[model samples]
Target: MNRQLTNSKLLLKPASASPALHRVLTVPQLWGIAVGLVISGEYFGWNYGWAVAGTVGFAAATVLVTIFYITFIFSYTELTAAIPDAGGPFAYAYRAFGPMGGFSAGFATLVDFLLAPPAIAAALGAYAHFLNPDLSPQWVGAVAYVVFVSINLLGVRDSANFSLVVTILAVAELLVFMALVAPGFQLKNVVAHTDSFGWSGVFAALPFAIWFYLAIEGVAMVAEEVKDPRRSIPRAYLLSIGTLVVLAIGTMLLCAGAGDWRQLATIDYPLPETLAMVLGKGSVWTSLFASIGLFGLVASFHCNTLGYSRQLYVLARNGYLPAFLGQVNERFRTPHWASIVGGLIGLGALFSGTTDQIIIFSVLGALVMYIVSLLSLFALRRNEPQLERPFRTPFYPVMPAVSLVLALICLLAIVYFNLLLSLLFVGLGAISLGLFWRFGRQRINVHLTTLGEAERH
Candidate 1:
């Protein structure tokens, strides 16, 4: 058994089970799933940047962030195709750098996936409250968590189908917003409102700019469930990002142009407010936009739960967490336990009622994951030159190098802008990893031993 482990074949071995995570997602469903995980950002969270850097500053930050993501996503798809693990970057790092590296990468993935849903939930709750002033935002969000987790628990096909429906509504909502505000869009509005937040302000806005495309990579977490991953994954990834870039730019320009930039700057439902300016404050169109806009938040909250559970499921299956977390519902074939727990955590964070702080911490985790995954790309290329790669990142070292440098810059800027919060994030992550290294190490060895025996038979 030990001799067989020498060649790293054991690393790819699955625990004794029928193939897990049903492959019900098709190319179109995957595209919707990918877009759904991120569309909410363009609708709400990115507006927060205006408060920090104004329209022009945030737009500059966004353009740079878009470049970072384009390069990063293109590079990242290569890893997804080659590895195609539900663990995503964790699996990539594990195959490249061993346990400790895997833990760090997995931890970062956990942080982002776990933290992001709460922010979206908060937005969901806010949108619900906007439509009906009597409803409690917190309760609305908590209900959404329960309902979506229930949906997710049913099965992957059901979840993906739900995602496709809501994702279409979300995209349609954006188009409606664009049409209503298109005639109102004036370049002078952005020009007149642009503030000199300086380079510092631009840096400060990086996290919010990131909100525009955050979690788009989450599609890779469902790699095990794709019909033809090697082809479908790359197509879904490229299309999703391309769609997001167009929506983001259109949304930003129209929103900034339609009203006082400050009006939407700190709001949860930026589009409705921008629409209010064009269509009258208390108009039916404004109310309709507000009601339908929840789909975007719902889309992200629902799909990100899918990503989170899969990441948690893979980690536990690999012995980085309690083995029970990896358990699938036999009837449903879904990661029911992980989904429930992740949703509960998001509910807890939503109770804090601080969206920006939650977002910053989440972005911090994403930044770390991005850097680690890119490193894994280079490490695997150098160490396992013969490993079959279905698709190679177009520019090789240059693309990843660009991604790394941009991600590092964003990380530094985030740290600089939110020193204490960054410190708290790093401290919590270090403590979690330290505990895992001390206690979880034995579990990994035992699991591997069992796996090796199972493979021998």
Candidate 2:
């Protein structure tokens, strides 16, 4: 009998009775999954920080958030490598602190993955609008939901292959964008608005800074499907994070220095607009960049759609969410219902609010999940020293401790700046939790009690 907290098999219904997730994903496909889930961040969303914090202030905020993500990812990969579950943060918390902890982290994680695509969808629509002035971005976003969800339903291997190709194109697009804009970059332009909001602006910009790397952790959701969960998951995470950090900072600086940073601050299609500033609005360069920019957004949209579906499927499988969503299509071996439900929800979000609003809400969910996940990492270390760790976080307590503290600070700052939206987020969590408690109390007790007896034997 294994005493280590390496899996929640005891807490879960015997997986032998369940439809298993495929394990065909390799390191490269995992990289595609990881980067595709987040590269859209490079395409749009972070510039909103510029509106609140100005160029220098936002850059400083980005630097701080980058540090937070680096430490957080190093610590988090330990859990993902050991557990290798689709529920990701949810599975980690359940192992460390039982059902309540799992629910808290899982709910936040659900929102983080679920809300992101709609925000990306809005940007997709905005990009379309930029190209053809009469195209309605919201409806264009609606159309994208149809296309990407269908791709996901095809099968994991097929979708992953598509992600790899688009991720390559997205990465290539960013590099091209930087090169094209570099000659126009001027130190004076970046410095022009340094005084607009001062230190306070940095705090306000934290969530947008977070926007730059929001869903990279989502790589964890695909852990079950990775060929070698222990070694492969960690490698994918490290590769994905390194790629994002370089691209994020480089894109932000070059775009800011290329022209008036303020102009890019409030829009969804900042890269295209930034290129227009450098290459002239009607220049072939602006048109080509705008058209190709869709690759980045499509990569993220396609990948995040996969992420949210798996989260939903796992939750349902564990009895936290409605059972119907857990059903995997026997033919495709994918969580088909979860994909459809998540897509419909994301489409509603795309049409209901502004892209920046959806982004902030998504960031709020991510901050909560980060704080809880870091806490779980600490708990697991104290409680389960025997657990297999293929990749240990470099600094141990210090690394995770720093990440936890930074997560707390970012959470507090966003709550302070957006009190109303913060309250709304809380209300949504509370209502969902209330419903879960009402319907799920008995089921959770059954799973935990069964697991407890199994462990004691």
Q: What is the C-alpha RMSD of each candidate to the true structure, in Å?
A: 1.8, 2.1
Residue pairs clashing, model 1: none
Q: State, as a TM-score between 0 and 1, how close model 1 is to the true structure.
A: 0.96
State the displacement of the C-alpha of residue 215, model 2, in Å, after optimal TM-score superposition.
0.6
> Against the hidden reference, what TM-scores do the models get?
0.96, 0.96
In angstroms, the error of model 1 at 53 is 0.6
> What tens digits encode model 2's per-residue C-alpha lDDT throughout 179-276?
99999999999999676488899999999999899999898888878898999999999999999999999999999998888889999999999999
Best candidate (score: lDDT): 2
Clashes of each: 0, 0
